[model samples]
Target: MLRQCTRPIPRWRTVSNVLYARCRTTAPCQPISPVSARTGWVGCLYSTAAASQSQPTTDGHIEILGRLHPTDSATNVSPTIVSKTTRRLHLQRNHPINILKRRIESHFRDYAVMDSMDPVVTVHQNFDSLLFTPDHPGRAATDTYYVNTNTVLRTHTSAHQSDVLKTRKADGYLLTADVYRRDEIDVSHYPVFHQMEGIRTFDKKKIEEEAKVDSETSAIQGAVLSESNPIQPAHTTREAQLVDLHLRHSLEGMVRDLFREEKDLQIRWIEAYFPFTSPSWEMEVFYRGNWLELLGCGVMQQEILDKSGNSDRIGWAFGLGLERIAMVMFDIPDIRLFWSTDDRFISQFSSGQIVKFQPFSKYPACYKDISFWCSETFHDNDFAEVVRDVAGDLAENVELIDQFQHPKTKRTSRCFRINYRSMDRTFTNEEVDRIQDQVRQVTKERLGVELR
Candidate 1:
């Protein structure tokens, strides 16, 4: 057997349940596989050394989990472990009996069912290779967990999308089963979590045109399109946002159908940010007039697309927390309840029943924009914070549309388009202008900004 640890083994009751539910048999629960048994032994041996973990001293002795691999080009075993620390930290996990678990099985079942006929149906990938740039914080020893030598637990399922795109068949739909890491270990956050990442590529010009039309539809709401009311460049600034919004709505709709009793289900798009997506968005579900964020999505960045050999085509993708959705559906407040090992919680949940979700608008949203000039001492971010404080709930989207440095004064000028539209009622031009004036005053007082 591989090295083994004496510490209490985590009960695999949840894992067993998952296997039983999906496989409908105890085949996977039998004797440990030969390979797994070997790995267990290795883990146990390493655990004895590392579990005695102690703080490193200036003398330079560091803690290591296992010995160096034979392929590492080192024939001699070092007496001391090398020390390297990273600044960035990440925590990741997946939960037991949680919504995410249920969803994964659901998707897996659907894929299996569909593949029986098409065989070309996209399926989720489980394991993925991980590479961190030399400068990447994740590469630092202090920031991540080391699984064996080259492999580490995946942080997010999306991490494998690039790998799948490069290796998998290029035709038909493809999905990946991935997980990611974060620092928080709380009721809501697990050390690992599951994510579904999807990819598709086609003619760019055609997709771009389709995106242009969708953008208009998204921005106008219920407005009817006509020759006079044409979609403008401003409307299609980010096709990814609109496309993501579409996907979110469709997903939420399907979720509601799955739980037939749910009602008034609506998906609202809110601005969000992430490194991999431009013009990213978070989808919120309206619950009892309160909004709860449910999912994140956006168009894939060009760099990621190029790396996947789809540089010539456009791509879009998204990820959602299954637990968060389940929480909203079941009115569960603390995420820990799902993993509490409490028989009551699990028994209370409806296995295959639909729950009703009523949608209602509590507060109206308003948007406005202002142009101003300021010294190099302040930037758009600084200005946005000030606006957020003054506008409160009345403010919708605040963005820097234009920026330039003065050729003569050496000062900077920024144009911000602030939107003002309330769910309650439309605002008068005068009312919005007055609020704009207040924002301008705050900017001037705080950052020495001058209204343009």
Candidate 2:
């Protein structure tokens, strides 16, 4: 049984429906008028080019999510990331990600399901609407995939919160979609992963009326709030408390239901921060002797609600990585496995089932280290992205093992160790050496870092 508490325990337990119309492959390709940033249109454009194995034009533009957008100096989205926009693992039947999505939707039975939204969004929609400040690090090309100066592949599903809330359709909704970020390669991290965003709004009048009759309107009792995580000034203490209670209760119930089959499930809440949410906290579940962070939730920023034309509604929103949860629930050891196409991998599970993943024979790993004089503009993620583009999943992990600053020259040197291994086969030394040679060449040519 899963036990939930506001405070941490020694160890332990714990723990969307929406169908958007997918782009039709059979449809003829046509060029549409260029999208304007000011239109605030949040919809998909289908292109026959998306269905073909076409490459980006020699011109300064690239095709993404079925639309052609001009690329610029800030164009850091690699072909590898662009290719994954169409995978839609969440939409694939009988896949683990899809199965997890279905299980979550079953828990939030009444929330509107919105799985189909364009992966491409305007900068305003992805950042400004979420109240992200101009100087936030996530806005950088190194961290996000920019389609152009004004558009990007969303870094998180929260990008759509304002647009969805503006609809005033469902009081509560669940949105599931693939999100992209430039990140290091590891068993647990990937450039693209699925995320489910959840929001539930309460009518101010209705909640106030309930507070009058209910003695326990404050659902989160004894939880501490600090200067950093203070409730919004616009909300009264009672309002914040009531909404906080509802949010925690709903999430706790969902977690309990998710791990109901496991014994001795333990879960806890810890204070956290996000740009769009105030007084935030993260939920962690004890899985296989580790406390894994499962999701983040908090009261929605009041300004966002105002912008959505729902001034009278107070709400709580949460965004969770489906891959993280699926990894824990299915006992899957590698994140890359979620993208595997092998029959042995895909045939093991069916929709609506939670079966442990069966491990195939393990492959041997090959390691190569490259040392280089560091450039001032060098970013680790950029180096990781380069390796990913060169080696794909065969490059399992890239880690910085040593760093030093030249005492006399005021320069820095760094050494990165890259682990080369294939999920389905062992790598020969000569093949790995060839790949390492290419990595060194590209690292110098692209990053301007001199090889040591």
lDDT of 1 at 400: 65
Q: Write the per-residue lDDT of candidate 2 for residues 67-149, one digit (tens) a residue.
A: 78887765667666787888888899999889988888899998999998999988998889988788766678776788778
Cα RMSD, each candidate: 21.1, 11.1
| Native-to-model Cα distance after best TM-score fit, residue 156 in candidate 1, in Å | 0.9
| TM-score result, candidate 1 | 0.44
Error in Å for residue 188 of model 1: 2.7
Q: Model 1: per-residue lDDT, tens digit, 1-452? A: 00112111111001110000011112222211111110000101112123122222224332233332222211111111111111001111223223334444364343221111110111122122222233544333332333333433343444455665675365224332323222221223332222334344444556545443344433324222233322222234344444444444444544455344546665555444344554544454555455544445555566666677766656555554444445445554433333332334344544444343222233444556677777655544455445434543345456567888889987777887776544334667787777777777766765677888
After superposition on all CA atoms, how large is the RMSD of candidate 2?
Answer: 11.1
- Per-residue lDDT, model 2, residue 46, is 19
**Poorest 10 consecutive residues of model 2 by lDDT?**
33-42
Say which candidate scores most in TM-score. 2
